[model samples]
Target: MSVKKISRHSPPNCGARAASASVLALMALLGAAAQAADTYNSDRPGGADHRLLSRYQGSLLYMYGEEALGKADMLFDDKGKPVMRPVEGRISNRMYWGPKKKSPLEVYRNYRHALETAGFKTIYACETKQCEAGAVQDAVQDLPRKVVWKDSDIFVENTFNSANQPGFHYYSGRRTGPDGDTYVSVALAGGYEDEPVFGRVRQFVQIVEPATAELGKVSVDAKAIGGALKRDGRIALYGVKFDTGQAVLRPESTAQLAEMAGALKAAPALKVYIVGHTDNQGELQGNSTLSQKRADAVVAALSSKYGIAPARLLGRGVANLAPLASNDSEAGRAQNRRVELVVR
Candidate 1:
């Protein structure tokens, strides 16, 4: 028998025990004999119905109870800024725990029960096992997914998992940001859209909303892009040696110079401000000075090697005033040390 799995990021006993017990109880009430013959759909209200919605939402909502604690653990990047990453992908899974004779739909209903019992606040879309390809929007568009595992679309859970915790998932889509550049995404599980089935009849769903145009598949030349964008915007560089806590520009940093040069050529009119940020490890003032030094170093590279007009370049030092990670830990502090570019 395929055992149901909770978000596995936490200690099994800490945040997940209630959901487990609830699922077990619901299964007992529904009778172990229940089986699903087909998947559920929202359009066919009679087919899947509000009863199922209540069940699904109830489970997901229960799961959300632990979200508060998860959010507490999040850390910011340097400059006390939250890191902005985009959605990667969404994934879902389900298992059969009830009677062996039910229709696939009935079996999927039980799967919803399990998710509900486990505390997920979810909504149903196309209850059937069909999904369309290509960029799809709308609540139902996300569901009715073609289940390769069992060939059906079941339900879309409505609640989101916090990024701070384990077992949560993310979704990705394409959209244009205010800056008009495409970026990639990272989001909570069930944020994207997908349907999965297992053990012959059970169903699960993953949801992803449309993304900003700024996000897409990451380009291979992010470093190059970094350079070009730097000239028109604030750009800073630090010498980084892999696996070392120290910061200094290495030979590879020259690549960033090319990026800045490219940006300068693209938008000669754009002005930029470069500031440095660092993780809080040692003296705050010292950290600030180091960050400033890194920014100055980048400025010097652009002026001396690339021969960019000095009027377009500006640099300043900022120390531990910005951090990408936590000072409490080495990893956080390491990520904290860096440079920033402000585009005007």
Candidate 2:
């Protein structure tokens, strides 16, 4: 055996370095994927920060004073009633979907965990068999029927129509936050669109903050109203107040009404339409009705109390058809909800 040069070349650390680089590259790719998945629009009213998973797609339909009205169980018909009670400030329903890889139960559990971690006390939770099918359907029906998403119907059919799966989950609870108390409800269902390959979930969130305080001082007086009418042919009145979900004017609205009367009296020849506009909170029909009622109330007040000619003021309610600002935020909604005097 000739002991030929048995010199063994030491193996380079290239393998280890390559493995490490591969892991880092994988991590970077994964990070990028996660970032891409975290692109849900959170520009909702009340709060923007939400504790939702990054993998799920989200759709939101929110109202400032939406009744948390739905069935909590299948015992009896909870129709037109808020089984979980009502939220005074803001109510939002967010729908989500993910691949079938994540089971409905898993999604429910993850949201439950998130709520718990965020100091929310679980008031109610139920699984597939434990949850009543009828109650779930009733609750889904309570959500807005027509939500426009990307210029198309979000819920193509009934909301409960897609939630006809065998395994479903529901949850409801309350939590206190820095601003005020908040309530949350969740529903998770399997097999969306008759397709057993996708999963769907919905979250109904209610944020109840202290009622917005009445403005201490009136921003628009008769002079300002007169100037605006002279220049812009219309003037939006912000000092007018109304009870939530009702056409009844609050007592604090007297000042604005007085100024409106004064403006009318000062300009006897000016005929205007008392147009009532509202934030897009409820159904178009209902909003239209409410706005008409509110406008009528204003007309009645000015005629009865302030002695303004009823013929010069024509009351009309256009509802949310003419919005001054985007209804996605509370401030914008407030701006949109106004009484406008349009010169006729």
Candidate 3:
């Protein structure tokens, strides 16, 4: 066919091209929004942004990937009846499942699969709320490949998910351990007693753990030491035996030591003073000696076993001075025997 001659300055085809490009841009924006709603920042703890988890107001939460399954908060319907609705991502109980009547392992597996399909590689999960120390350790040991645990506390692990987005999930129930390691768990969310409002497809996206520089691990007991380490320059660690009064280091102390060592190593400039205490059973002088001995023992272990410097280790004896529990009873006496660390 003979080609028709085209004028060099004819109305450009730019109109159609511009319209196509606009459509493409709109699609891209929409796609990005959808993705944002789907992805998890494993480092973000709660699957949202750092600011939201930093202050953490309200009881609303939005579940992505495994979190979306069968979770919602109860709201009174227009008919004065209770209904479940989507909880805001930052608010607590947003995806409250109330209580699980089924097996926690089942729930964990289901969530794990759902998360994996969404391409979230850092999957943190728990089986129950009251888990045994051994159970939690086992769960941690059994974590899927490539998932790094920030702490051994199952409950805190859940909160870690709430604070970060790398495919974090939690389960409610109890875990029992036979003296392997004391498993401390923090229930950050879940148990809202509602059904799933989102569709069956759980969204998952890659997320970096919240920068260790901010919104770090969370602690529920006492001073919330985990957050202290991440947000503040100092974290005070006190070691105590179970049932109190016993100056001997308890098994739980192992976990704390591990954490303290790691914190010191991570921040080379950090220094810590390890203090030991004894109950009031013995004479003041004897208790002081015992406390000093215990403190020295800790220093020796840290320096020799863990490679912490003697200069970095300061041992103090607080003899029956700091009592967390009443010393009137044997239980309280047990509480008085402890070792603590003051960050310098």
lDDT of 3 by residue, 1-344 (tens): 99877679875676888999999999999998766544321122453322212212221233322221122221223343222232211112122221223333443455445434534332133434323322333333222122232222332224323222222234221122221111111122223121321211121111222111111122224335444655664443444333333445546566566666666666667676777766678688887877887787778777786788888888888788877767664445545555666776
Candidate RMSDs in order: 20.8, 15.7, 18.3
lDDT of 1 by residue, 245-270 (tens): 34455566665556556666566775
Per residue, candidate 2 scores C-alpha lDDT tens digits across 199-225 of 444433333332333332475789889
> Largest lDDT belongs to which candidate?
2
- lDDT of each candidate versus the true structure: 0.40, 0.64, 0.43
lDDT of 1: 0.40
After superposition, which runs of candidate 1 have C-alpha atoms over 4 Å from their true positions?
A: 1-248
List candidate 3 segments past 4 Å from native.
1-226, 229-253
Using TM-score as the measure, the top candidate is 2
Q: For every model shown, what is its TM-score relative to the native structure?
A: 0.32, 0.41, 0.32
lDDT measured at residue 318 in model 3 versus the true structure, 0 to 100: 78
Where is model 2 more than 4 Å wrong at Cα? Answer: 1-219
In terms of lDDT, the poorest run of 10 residues in model 2 is 68-77
Give each model's clash number: 77, 1, 51
Query: How far in Å is the alpha carbon of 47 misplaced in model 2?
Result: 24
